[model samples]
Target: MHEQNPALGLVHVLRAVTVEFDLLGAEFAARHGLHPTDVRALIHLLDATRAGTRATPGWLGEQLRLHSAGTTALIDRLERLGLVRRSRDTADRRRVLLEVEEKATELGWAFFGPVIGEVLAAAEGFEAAELETVRRFLTSVLESVGRARSA
Candidate 1:
């Protein structure tokens, strides 16, 4: 009998997690009358705001692997739904920033709050060191995947 490669096992686990996450995202999108891609773009915009950074349509395009026209259409759709708005950057007048609407934030938290609380509660079971290890591992995985995609 041959032993399975640990790396291969980890890859399988990660793949399963990715699939589950995608399914969850799809469900969330459907509940909000959005496509999965739009939900993901909105999440990215929200995260950027949380990090004190503004997200531009071009940046969102790159993040979502969308072209300029597609990104514009997405922004238009979200803007029409009142989930996001486009504002000119104060410092860079030529730059248009995507801002998630307050109502959208409220809706997101209302919909995802329970799961967020559960995930936070689960994290409390881990020690600080274990959490740090997990964070580092996930970051490394993200880097590796980014490199692979670019390559």
Candidate 2:
């Protein structure tokens, strides 16, 4: 249903997409016996890795809005599950950095691989210029949401 205000329609569509992803995350969390925050932390860790940034406890705490004790506890749990490991930064022997384990990647791929493939197939139908416009729009939305979160 197209609305007179295209922006409002876009907002509704985005919200629907967000809800579906949230539900998928919830399912994954339940299946793996993990907390919602754990899934969120893993996602952030993955994103940091993709961005070529070292993920430290302090940085993760800031990203997750968690305090030291909470972050430590989360790390400990993930560590026990074999999903993450803490390694001392080679360049800075005293600093610790978080890393996602192979097990975590395997588990994530097993669960999300099909969905990612479906998304890719859908994206393949879009022309390059149309996809670029969609990418720019989503990037702007992400930036705006980040600003709102910190405000």
Best by TM-score: 2
Candidate 1 lowest-lDDT run of ten: 107-116
Model 2 lDDT per residue over 47-132, tens place: 99999999999999999999999999999999999999999999999999999999999999999999999999999999999999
lDDT of 2: 0.97
Q: Name the runs in model 2 displaced over 4 angstroms.
A: 1-3
Task: State the lDDT of candidate 1 residue by residue for 29-139, as single tens digits.
Answer: 899899998989988998898899779999999999999999999999999999999999999999898899988899888888988899899999999999999899989
Span of ten consecutive residues with least summed lDDT in model 2: 1-10
Name the best candidate (by lDDT): 2
Q: lDDT score of model 1? A: 0.91
What CA root-mean-square deviation does each model show from the true structure?
Answer: 1.6, 1.3
The models' CA-based lDDT, in order, is: 0.91, 0.97
